[model samples]
Target: MSLNTIDIVVFIAYVLGLIGVAIYVSREKAGHEKDANDYFLAGNSLPWWAVGASLIAANISAEQIIGMSGSGFKIGLAIASYEWMAAITLMIIGKYCLPIFLEKKIYTMPQFLEQRFDSRVRVTMAVFWLGVYVLVNLTAILWLGALAINTITGVDLMAGMIFLGLFSVAYSLYGGLKAVAFTDIIQVVLLIFGGLFLSYTALDLIGQGNGIVAGFAALTDQAPEKFDMILAKDHPHYIDLPGLSVLVGGMWIMNLSYWGFNQYIIQRTLAAKSLEEGQKGIAFAAFLKLLMPVIVVLPGIAAVILLPELERADQAYPQLMNLMPVGLKGLVFAALVAAIVSSLASMTNSIATIFTMDLYKSDAKPRSEQHYVTVGRIVSFSALVIAMLVAKPLLGQFDQAFQYIQEFTGFFTPGIVVLFISGMFWKKTTANAGLAAAIGSFVLSIVFKYAWPTLPFMDRVGIVFLSCLAIAVVVSLFENKVQDNAVDLDGVSFKTTAGFNVSTVAVIAILIAFYSAWW
Candidate 1:
């Protein structure tokens, strides 16, 4: 995949333009180096559009671009459950979850735990999240991004990793979440356009240049099996996707933990100007999520039909990129890079936010807001450096990067979800119960992974979630209830503006139509 002069210019211009936009938007006003609020939560002033765009930008990283595409290549449209399910999850979160989070005025997920449970639960979960964000989330994005860049440009993988790390750190370290969120607007736009361009061109090639409709028709006619949204038990890929469980089982656990509870993801909505603004932004993201498979997943299915002999599934996306002519190739490549860098920036900012707010500020006592912001920058730099060093080695072990991420992250999500749900809704859930559920879920996940190896990971997640919920309930029964510490139940409304309601209904209708067509 060699680049001509036009391609080189387009890619270089796109990179420089992205950096310039991030720097420009994130620039400090005179006499106002960001305080904790400004740096961490964008001064709690993100408009609905920025919130929606940043949410998608942060969520769709190299993981979706490279990894989900790889999964699509290997297992077909079943991989799209992650994206589609997330739409429904985001809707539920916006309606039911965001109002509580806004009313509480919490900055991070760990902070919410502390408010509802205790500092012990908060600190334990905080440390665990820090490790996962730095080690697993950050590393996977860098590793997979570098691999894609290496495939596209023939750059050394290590060099690509360092380049991406430095690029993400350069802007995000100074501007923090404000810069990350605002820059993500452009990132999301490029990612959507670039991804669509790639998918469209690939489909065009399949149609022998007839048109997208003809290409789609040829695609279905030739590779009908690749379009299955549900897999049978005997299917080779069943262990990963597992049919109806995707709709009714552990996939929901994953989506809830991710869209509802994950810090980097939810942090965007947390920055919204008001509860209404946040809800609308989330609803907007839900609409975009429905379109994601066209940009992210369909290309891989197209790849299978177009380039069937590729040795590695991960190579599906980049190999498809090789089919593009000069300028479009660079635009698509820029979109890929945008996806990677934006996610890296989002994760780095999140790692810093969690560390500075949940850990450093808690331990250091009240400092100047500026002081904590500085600490955030330091943590961001340190985490990025560590991720750059660790990413290459970790990714080498996985045959399917996306599944490896899901299965490994699955280990802790069930427990985290149980803790959050119990603490939020159940007044009887004691702090000890929350802590015990957290620890017990991890132990049970380990047992499922090692001792019960034949269990599907999704099923394992469901089992662990149910078992941990039971454990928390039993433990809470043994402890005295503290109703004062429970999440406030007053004035919690699922109501939204008419526009948002109509949009939500439209999204659900579209989803139903899709499943009917695809199933």
Candidate 2:
């Protein structure tokens, strides 16, 4: 819980190194200032590795690292279905979805909606995302991250939040997504290695001086109940996991909305050097997905054996950090901070991208690309400031801010998935139908929540998604009019390279083996 000189040195070094890299990677060429594309989309020139690393860095944060570890402590590996299922979801999106987005040369998800539906749909979704990202996503990341740091190091909560906000801005504000995407490579490396090492330390504690393999055996032996990949109907946490629904139902809806349609997460893929490069990057992310539970989940499971009666499950990771030896404690702490700020930077960048590109550019007078890029930087800073200011007011009262935020977001995920999926694939899908799906998804979700209170959340999501699809279909059928804005896939290729194909097989095979062994 205490950081000695060694830990302080390591942490400071990480901060300086990350900032230097961000500045170096985002430097302007002589006589050429950064344009909108360069700032927002990283000049559309990211290699497969940077794109892949940034996506994972953007997705995994304090919420996943700390909250999921808590879930591991409480619910065992069942909590990891979200991570594991996302692996396949990434592959599916890479194969079928990224092509559509990349081919359109869009800057944000809302832009794609404008192309296929209308400006109204685009504006509506843009406003919705901006609200959620600022009030919910950004706030939760900041609050939870600060809380994690405070727990481990006794730092004041407000100071921790301020440091995170400033650090995120320091490395990312000036350079925009280019800074975020490139610096994220360092963040991802630290988080992955630090997380895996922490898991090893915790497992080794359980092994009582035995090696990692023996530690693994001890975990399965001592806390066998936690290892179940699928929960039973009577399991206390079944409501959260919902047995098979995770595999066949609403979990897919959740993953698609996040991995395929969400702005911040998809922005990485959108920045790829080419369609093929992006798809390859996505495949790489899928492989990384398979390893997340080890980095994020295993430590909490180890806690069941290490500190079995902790007051709260959420304390699993922070308290477990007490076990990290002094020399490496700073390194692991840097890893934790890496995920936090990388996610913070990614969210702020996306918020600015959506506001500046989708809303600001549309309404503001035409100007040079530098003008918009400047606006983006200002917006990014403003969003971070607002989030830091309001984070406590918004999230302070919640015991499980992470879960509450997730549940609140789920109210609309089905509708979003339906609107995008129908608009993209159904040629006759009308604008009115898009509105119907988008709006109906939320209203029906509320009705279902109160009327069928006991329905598993995953099941509710799947049911609402199907209902939205049906409503969209009925509305479109009622109009029975020809449409011209359906997605044009003739120009996009679905073929995968030999490397991608082989990687896909390897990822799936690994997932299958993992679940089967733990099942």
RMSD of each: 1.2, 1.2
Clash number by candidate, in order:
0, 0
Q: By summed lDDT, which 10 consecutive residues of candidate 2 come out lowest?
A: 398-407
Per-model TM-score on C-alpha atoms: 0.98, 0.98
**Model 1 C-alpha lDDT versus the unseen true structure:** 0.89
Q: Which runs in model 2 stand beyond 4 Å of their true positions?
A: none
Model 2 residue 262 CA deviation in Å: 0.4
The local lDDT score (0 to 100) that residue 61 gets in candidate 2 is: 94
Measured with C-alpha atoms, the lDDT of residue 485 in candidate 2 is 82
lDDT of 1 by residue, 319-382 (tens): 8998898899999999999899999999988999899888888544678888998999899889
- Expressed as tens digits, the lDDT of each residue in 410-463 for candidate 2 is 899999999988988888899899889889988988999999988888888999
Clashes of 2: 0
Which pairs of residues collide in candidate 1?
none
